[model samples]
Target: MNVSVSRNSSHSEPRSLLAGVLAVLVHLIFVAMLIFGLNWKDHPPEGMVVDIWTELPQPTREPVKTVPSKQEPKPVQEPVKPKTEPPKPEPPQSELPPEPVKSEPPKPAAPQKAVTTPPVKKPDIALKQKPEPIKEEKPDLQEQKKKEQEKVKEQEKLKELEKQKELEKKKELEKQKELEKKKALEKQKELEKQKELDKQKELEKQKELQKQKEKEQAIQRQREQEAKAQREAEAQRAAQQAAARNLVTNEVSKYKALILAKIRSRIVMPPDLPGNPVAEFNVTLLPGGDILDVRLSKSSGHAAFDSAVERAIFLSKPLPLPPDPALFGEFRNLNIKVHYRE
Candidate 1:
């Protein structure tokens, strides 16, 4: 078949195989120099066949002989000197024995003399200062804002001096209430001028008691007009002396009613005054009428009841004298007033 495969014939190794293609092209150049030394960057990849070699079935041959002998080697030993005396130095072994007595470490006490602290006088280092000029805080903040505006103008002049001392204590309490209302209007005009001078001294004492009661009523009407003109001239001389002494106008009116019932039975009264049962008073009579003035113009609290109304008006003294000397001035002004009403 004219075959030989030594190597390159454009790879397909068939043109009659040249020495098995030159051992497969020396194992494919040892696998392309181991893939270009493990492929750095060229792009030549794909050819894989690496089987190395193992198909063997022929290797057998044998025959050859020869013998000869010779020998050598053995020797070594040299120190030898006799012993005796220098062993006396064995006494130095007591060195560790000396350490056993380590009792001396306590000698450190002898170094204690360093306690002398007396040199401490070094405090005079007071020299580092010099830094002062920083005071302009804006003129101490404008003198603390002018001492807070002069403490707010002394608190607004103490609130306008406490509102002018409260308007001078309200004008001194309204001038003490207008001087106590002008002293109560001058004590009500001096009590209305002392009530008009007590009504002009009570109208001049009631006009002097009505002019002494009209001059005692015109002196009792001129003593009753001279006792009625002496009773009409003794009644015309008792009718011409009763026609020449024959006087019997019914026994001259029965002895003039028995001398007015004997002076009204002695006009009694006094058991302490106030009487009025008819014996009122004027019983005096005679040119010689005895009981002159038995006091009480109006008395009653008495000296024995005004001496029992003056012994009952002197027991009605010479009283029956009414033969009419014109009724003797009505018993000569004998005013009496006794009133008792059991």
Candidate 2:
């Protein structure tokens, strides 16, 4: 039960604190609203009237002194009333003037009480006091009017000052708003510029990639053209080489036939040559196709036919050769075969 009570109290404490905070907030909001909503100049404040009384009237002393002085004059006049029985009615009328005489009576009453005060002196002094109060009251009223006017002028000056301050505050707030707007516009412009720069960079990258691709394609085409040119040149060179070799072989064969025909034409056959026996010869020649040396490598099995072939070759001194000097190597050494025909 104690714990539950404590919990309840704690909860109540927080709720009270929250309520207090809300109340304070509400009060602050109300004050702020009043500050903004109320106009100072519309309701002019009342002018303060300050009384600066230089001299205060002795009304208390006047009342006290006048009462006793008027009563004392009555006692003195009552005795005089019997002394002057013929002027008894005049004495009561004389007492009426003493009421205003109280202004100066207090100053001379103690010394002049036994010496009967003059009747003419009381009426003159009383008349002078009445005019003096009237004169003092007139100046007091004028001074109060002046003070009120001055206070009003001061209030107007304060109101003007407050108005000027409010105008300045409004101008400052407008300037701040304009500055904030300028800053926001500049930030937005910067963001747009950044976006443009990013776009330009992307375009440049794409262009660079395109250029690289074009260069690669051009390079591949050039390489293909170069390879085709190389292959054609190789085929033409092989064909030319083969044609040159065949031409050299044909020239060599023609020269060999000429040489053998010349030698055979010069041969002198022996009589009764038996059944066409064959003979072979080994010959060495010079660059000019001159027979340098000749040897019989095979006999015809007839000594006379072999002797005839050997003699025929020596008689044919320089053998026939190809016109081209490059073909001389083929005729540098020669092997010849002959047949003896009857």
Candidate 3:
């Protein structure tokens, strides 16, 4: 019964151990899937190309004409006119006084001759002038070509900056996924360790209960053994006491007969005493068989015979007794009857 109970208590299920193994297997499978499922090919981004075209300006032209150099001349000046000789004036103012005295007659004489005057002419000169010529302008082409080249270079730089921004964004996303995976693995390990601790505590409790039960059983067996020993000792003591009592009773009976014989030897009977006489006496003795008192309970009816029996008892002092002191109480006080025949 003890062996069966111990076996049942000692054995336990291995559930926690099996759970730990299963968790490890699940983690391994997840790692394998990550390795095979993800895309790892290296594919760089494609670059873009742009084209520009411009037209050049055309030049303009103008026509030329000639001018003439001819001119006209000026007119000449006119001649002067002649004058009539003044009638002879003169000579004669001194003699004119004599001529005035005869004036009426002189007028009639001048009408015979009348005087006349002539016309005049003008002079001329010649001169000329000349004409002037015209000029043209042109355009430049090299400065226009330099401005178009600078515009094309600026557009290429802007496209390169946009491509760099896209690459940085992709790298940030990959880093975030890796951090999440690490956190999940740590949580799984903590749960497995907690389960193992709980299993160990349960096993310790079972062992303590088994030890307490065994201790109680041992104490019960010890108590039953002590009770059996006590009952056997009591039975043996009662048997020994019964054997001692029977031996003392037998020794007392033998000493009683010797005491009677000693008293009978001292008796002296009267010869005229009638009939057979039986007298009963009560004797009281000390532990050492010394007589203390004696009384006749039944008399033989003859005074002389009774007196003789009393004197015999007084002579037999210090009666015989049993060897064992423990039997003395039975004989301390006794009743005996004596029969005398003649």
Candidate 4:
């Protein structure tokens, strides 16, 4: 479809349109070149359109023509007329005299300033206006002797101090030994006193047993001489006594009024010995009238009083028992002691 247009028509005007096309075409070519080469691999798929707008240089106005400065014409100078004269003749090189000689005196060497340092004032070395000679140090002879003497003196002082300390230590040890010996002697005395008391108690117990045995023998002999009826009667009497103690103690709380009076009448107040001594003791008696043993638990200081107490205990052997079982154990060979007051 060719549409031919007339000259000067807007559609037929190709120059302006060609210029605009050329500008766009040039931009597209540049972008295509960048995408295909520099940035092609990094941005493979997307066509990165970059607007690279640049500012073009501004058009400069042409300089206006300036009138040149007119310089003043130099004065017209006439050629100088040469003087008409014969030239002066030059001196011959061989005949010329030597140049005037310059006078120079020999230079004296520069004088040196005096280089000596000023003497310093020396320190005063004299001792109080006394002209005593300096004594040489007796390093080899006198000092050795002095040091030896000092060493000897120091050694002697140390030895004396050591001896005094040793003497004090020995004295302390002797005192300790004496104290130990005294303690041992006191312990020995105590043990000896205890042994003597034990011997005395044993002897007293033996004597009491002998006396009880004699009394029992005499009673037995007397009973043997009596007739059968009389023996039976005596046995009955003993049996009654056995039951009496039982009946009394069994109802002791009820009959305490009667028992207290009976005990008080029989209780004897022994004589007072010297010391404020107390002997606490215990004993267990058998059914028979024989004392099995007498034990002294605590010892009174007085020997005669303690012995007397032990003797009393043995003499009161085989303490009466209650007939009934309920009251039997009340005084059945149980704990007791000899109680006496002055």
Candidate 5:
């Protein structure tokens, strides 16, 4: 159980750990929900009421004054003039016959007395009674035409001013609409920029998380490989130790036979050797199978034969040793006996 736990812990990924944590949290939330009931109903929104009351204006009352009473006019009394007595009737004179007068001869009559007559003076009343000059029809008509032209010019000027004002108002409205459109476009662009920025941030975060996960997995794999290699090394070391402890003599003999065969193949013997003789040699070897020394322990009493054996040993250079380093002690100073037969 403990080994299984350790193995699971070593191989578990972050995703699995997070899932387990989430599962626990979900269970806890479920239990909490069961213990405490939820209140899901929403409260109703409050309403506002507005009342409008308007009062009617009162009528104004004027002050009343008493009027004076009218009086009846009195009748006028005219003064009476005394009536004058009629003038007395004039007396009538009786008519007489006309008398005939005789003609007088060439008598100069005396100048009649000059009668005195009052001088009559004419009244001189000064009054300005000059006759008014007659007005010309042509000049009056021209003046009327000038006044009509001035009225027409004033009406045209008023119309032009109204047109200019209308045009200005239209231009102002167009400018306002354009400004609103520009502001809307700017707001949209800003929103798009913000959205792009958020997307970029999210992508970067995901990339960082992926990279971290990969790094962790790589580290885990490295640790597993290292552990496996260590285990293998330990097992190999133990096997080697066991094999060294149990050294087989037959295995040693096989190595010795291989060494002898190698040396014999390189030996150059002389034909004049008398009888078949056996030569014995003690060879000192290193753990790596390199010969340190070769000394003649027993000889066939032939110098040439001894010399040939020495030369053969020298030519062999590095001798064959046991494969196991622990068994190297057996071949450190190996003794070999060789026989040459004709």
Candidate 6:
């Protein structure tokens, strides 16, 4: 028993050691995972950089108009001043060419400040440049207006396209929702159908099991009934056989009494007999109750009484017997005992 215990301990030690090692490894792995997760979560989120343009520098066409606006009024020629006088005050600085050309609509106040200053007159050389600059500025302003109108149309078109895309996305989402709903309904219906079939099968299975149980019970009951009936019949037959045996025993006793009485009557007692002596004989008889043979089974000590009893037995040739042929076997061989003195 000790050796078996030691062997069991030896076998279990490695398994226990392996389990302990695995537990330690799992703990280490869990700790590592925790460390990694903590380090990953602790880091700060990166910043997003955006560059905002405060002013768009239009240096090509806008420089010409802006420079002229600042310098042209400084050199207002005396002859051209009167001719351009009506047009100068009439043009509001808010509707300036720089607004359309440079795309700086919010800086309209800056241009109004510049344009509000009184014209500074220089020499006659600046007079000739004034009319030419005014002619060029007129055509540039018209072209700028047309470009601004085209930009507005492009913005409207982009907005309409974005709206159409949003509507299409909505439609697609609705369609997907409808499809998902349909699939869910179909799946639910299929599950219901499968459940119903399972229920039916279960019901059928229960029915079959019930039927089988009833059938087994019926078979068992039939077997028990048959066994019971067989037992009853056997008991009845045994009772009948016992009664017949008792009747035969009673009939045989009755015939034995009659034989003993006849033998007692025939015996002649001897006067010289001292005491009563019992004499036993084995007698063989024919079916007619006639003595076939007689043998002394026991002697009475008195010789005269024994002789007289034997002679008397021979005289009574035909003895009484049962009338039933079936009872003749009982009287075929008889044992008779007689006593003298009565």
Query: TM-scores of the models, in the given order?
Result: 0.23, 0.47, 0.37, 0.21, 0.32, 0.40
Per-residue alpha-carbon lDDT of model 2 for 66-100, expressed as tens digits?
A: 65466545544464444445344434434553443
Cα deviation of 296, candidate 5, in Å: 20
Instruction: Compose the digit string of candidate 1's lDDT tens values, residues 1-342.
Output: 234444445467456577788889998999998998878857666676566633211110000011001110110001001111111222232333233222332232122112111111111121111111212445666556656754765575566557556655654565556445645654654564455446445544554454455445545655566577778778878877886345444444454455445544554544544444322344333465655554444445544444454555677566454454544554565544443333
Clashes of each: 20, 0, 10, 0, 0, 0
Residue-by-residue lDDT tens digits, candidate 4, 1-342: 134454336455559878999999999999999878786467466767766633211111111111111111111111111111111111221133121111111121111011111111111222222122222546555445545644664575456546555654654565456446645755564565455456546654664565456555555655565657688888999999889866675565443333333323444435666646666555554544345666777777666666766666565544444334455444434444334452
Clashing pairs in 6: none
> In model 3, what lDDT does residue 71 have?
10
- List candidate 3 segments past 4 Å from native: 1-219, 269-277, 302-305
Residue 260 miss distance in model 4 (angstroms): 75
Model 3 residue pairs with clashes: 75-124, 76-122, 76-123, 76-124, 77-122, 77-123, 78-121, 78-122, 79-120, 79-121
lDDT, residue 322, candidate 1? 43
**What is the lDDT ranking, best to worst?**
6, 2, 5, 3, 4, 1
The TM-score measured for candidate 4 stands at 0.21
Give the poorly placed runs of model 2, Cα more than 4 Å off.
Answer: 1-186
The superposed Cα distance between candidate 2 and the true structure at residue 264, in angstroms, equals 2.3
lDDT of 4: 0.46
Residue 61 lDDT in model 5?
10
C-alpha lDDT of all candidate models, in order: 0.45, 0.68, 0.55, 0.46, 0.59, 0.68
Model 2 lDDT-worst window of ten: 111-120
Residue 246 in candidate 4, Cα distance off native in Å: 53
Using TM-score, give the best candidate's number: 2
TM-score of 6: 0.40
